[model samples]
Target: MQMNGMNIKPVTVILLVLLLVGFYYYYYYYYYLSQYRFNVPPCPTSCSTSEPKDRVPDVIPTDYVFHLKTPDHLQYSQPSIVKGRTDVVAVTPWLAPIVWEGTFNPVLLDSIYKQKKINIAVTVFAVGKYIMFLKNFLETAEKHFFVSFNVHIYVFTDRPKEVPKVNMAPGRQLTVRSVPSSNRWQEISARRMELIQKLIEEQLRKHSDYIFCLDVDSQFHSRWGTESLGGLVAVIHPGYYLDDRGKFPYERRPESRAYVAHGEGDFYYCGGAFGGLLQEVFLLANTCRSNFEEDAKNGIEAAWQEESHLNRYMWINKPSKVLSPEYLWQDFKPRNPEVKTIRFSGVIKNYAAIRPNV
Candidate 1:
């Protein structure tokens, strides 16, 4: 075992060498050997699949959108016109329901939506260091968001290589689209509407029935299932839903296209999460993208970027269903008495570190 001052074991030396050799081959197989077998090309800095030739109209029948003509009794609770949540205002002045827990029966809603066999498409952006949040966002989604539905997740990110490989359920799939990186966070945030509009126009319109655009740095904590489905859905921002319209942080400048005249706005909807029937969301995204571009032409930016534009758009075109603060609660905020559950929430993040610019 010891020769002079040096202790040595032939069996130990042999085992250590074998371990290093095993690791080398393991890495080689996955890193190089696998690629060689498949004849794969190197990924580009910004890569994208070629555009499809055929494009289709973005439309869905309005009739029977909520109800089935010939109904099947799925057997849930009795009708609750007067026996629901009394603490919170359940419906907006425009008659759009503000969805909170206990307001709707999930079983009944899921059953109806299941019958349609509709496809739900979700788009999330993870450019720059925001790619770090994709794993939890996607993993939590598989657990809570539309668990049994036909779902497609379109991830738009500059760092496609960093996109996490989440094993989705049978009816769910993920698509990654590479976008050029940006230096300004405002540019990345504002350009989301443009990218979503193009996504719908180019690909989603053909097979997708609905689409939800969500922020990447968020996770689903509860059911954001078929119950939230509608023609146009907007989540009431958790930060300012309880505040007055004057303090609501709308774009106040008349020069900006996103400007909302004083006393001429509804609920402050979040830009982080919004969606609807394919055509409805297409129209919303298109309008916001155009207005944002027009404002750029005039050399003015809104106070809150795309969020301001979204508020202005929602003023003229009311959201068909408004989700409460429960839908998009902030991780930093304490749970309010009215919020029975947090469905989908933005995770607390250091903006300076993750964002390209703060």
Candidate 2:
């Protein structure tokens, strides 16, 4: 209708209102209902709550003492047997690198290739303590990567039964290897060295081509598939310090071989989530012994924790590929623009309610 010098359309007004209503509904459905949000509780300052006291004891004694040998003494070997044929083999080696040069050759490609499978191995202690986080980790991993390709999760847990049964993809498999529990979670990485060594010797000798060692306390939030694979990949540590290396917290000791050798490096990487060619990891795992022992002597069980040792090894022996910080991230801080994805998010939870006192 024409009124005065302007034209008014009743149909246009009605159409605009409908469009606004439709947009609101669409936003609400996708933003809130479709996505899964985890509500992380705040951590307490003091150790009074169920939180485990950070008792940095003078030194914890161990029955077993490890000695580092020269490169000549160390063996450069190959996989003893090849059980299954796979496009890419993944493994997390703590110790004992079975020779596998004959089984698979380390190929450096100019561009990324299609990955048929990804294998992840985690060294777990009391499953009951971090069961919730482990469950979430497995579920998130499957959602982000396993759905698209064949993925196998191998967990070396002290208590396998405590691990819940979650749905996995068609080619997905979860293998649980029994381990011993430790008084401190930090010590698990060190104490389980023997267990991991044995497992690699027996099971992972020639099973996987690529391997990732992950902490059970982390969860997956982004796409972490074959694209992240290479000769050696280390994620930027969420707790890395840009200033003086001394200011950097965690189990960093300058006198230690890992830190002392690489005194002037750009950044320190976290061992929570790391991947590499099976041969490279096996070599490092078998050779990097001095740093691990030095950290143990100072009453440091896991020595810079595991990541510290890994950083030192990488410093001395630079890997072919160095991944960005997005690979394995922690929930201690907010996200950064440079971060493409986070392999693990440490959701704060009630520790006392979950884990009992040792």
Candidate 3:
């Protein structure tokens, strides 16, 4: 074909038109469809015009009975079984069919035996300055807990070399895992969850149990390990909303698998300090990946960081135990008389103290 003394191939023109059309369709499906896909679910009619259905039964049945037992009475005391085998029992029923068990023995039955070794994992950005606070917190935690309870601190950081070299207690251990740095704290937190999942899969030995994911900036007080083992435990966020009516960092959209819309219930949870059997951590890690992936496609960074995702997961999957705020005391407010110790005291020098400037 000839156009203005220049020859144009008919096939080329057709190909260009088709390419443009394909590009248009791709955007429509990825952008437009994504919006519709993530739209929030409608509020319940009871919440507005009618009463919501009774989620719990008003009358108790004779056959329905609740029994509380000590950790010794439990079926399994290990985190998980080997990946493919089913013979292993879970430390808690919530973490079914334990795949593998960690070496950290439970100190549940006797206070004297309660000093068993425990492994704690932390995800940090450039928390170099905060290292002292963490060390102080751990030191305090050791003094309050059973003297025999050993702690192996696993620090997942972006700048491994920059992490402050601190002296740990005799039973305390520290290991750092490296990650890519990000300016957005929320993005960093979300990616840290992913990094934790990877470490559990690769670095963590099969014999390890009781994995804890903690914020690098937070400190651990005396009440850190008083609770029983083999179950999921979370500290109350001093920032937690008393009622669902109040606006919370909790993710509320239905399109988001992490949505928490029930205004009358307690679904939101703080992620500052959380620990459970190894199998449970694996499950939680898997859930975090799904929620984070969904949020990423929508251009929404991890809502309120990874805590929001954790809150959503805990809501649907009730933890074995719900701990009071004493576990992870954020440094935001003055300490209460009853509070034993503060975790991430905001008084820390600066981000440079613990984290790298980069």
Q: What tens digits encode model 1's per-residue C-alpha lDDT throughout 61-106?
A: 4343745532465567788676879999989998999899999888
Stretch of 10 with least lDDT, candidate 3: 56-65
On residues 1-358, what C-alpha lDDT tens digit does candidate 3 reach at each position? 8989999999989999999999999999776555322222232432221211212111211221122234444454555544432332233344422212222233443332342333444333334344445555555545653345566667655557756566667766667766666554556667756776676666663435566766555554443443434356554566553444455677666656466675733535667667665555655666677667867787665457678777766665557765545555556577675444453332334554333433
Looking at model 3, residue 152 earns an lDDT score of 66
Ten contiguous residues with the weakest lDDT in model 1: 46-55
- What TM-score, over all chains together, does every model reach? 0.83, 0.60, 0.60
lDDT of each: 0.84, 0.53, 0.53
The model with the greatest lDDT is 1
The most accurate candidate by TM-score is: 1
Residue 17 lDDT in model 3? 99
Question: Which runs of model 2 end up more than 4 angstroms from their true locations?
Answer: 1-112, 115-128, 192-194, 241-246, 249-255, 261-263, 294-303, 340-343, 350-358
lDDT at residue 148 of model 1 (Cα atoms)? 92
With candidate 3 superimposed using the best TM-score fit, by how many Å does residue 5's alpha carbon deviate from the native? Answer: 95
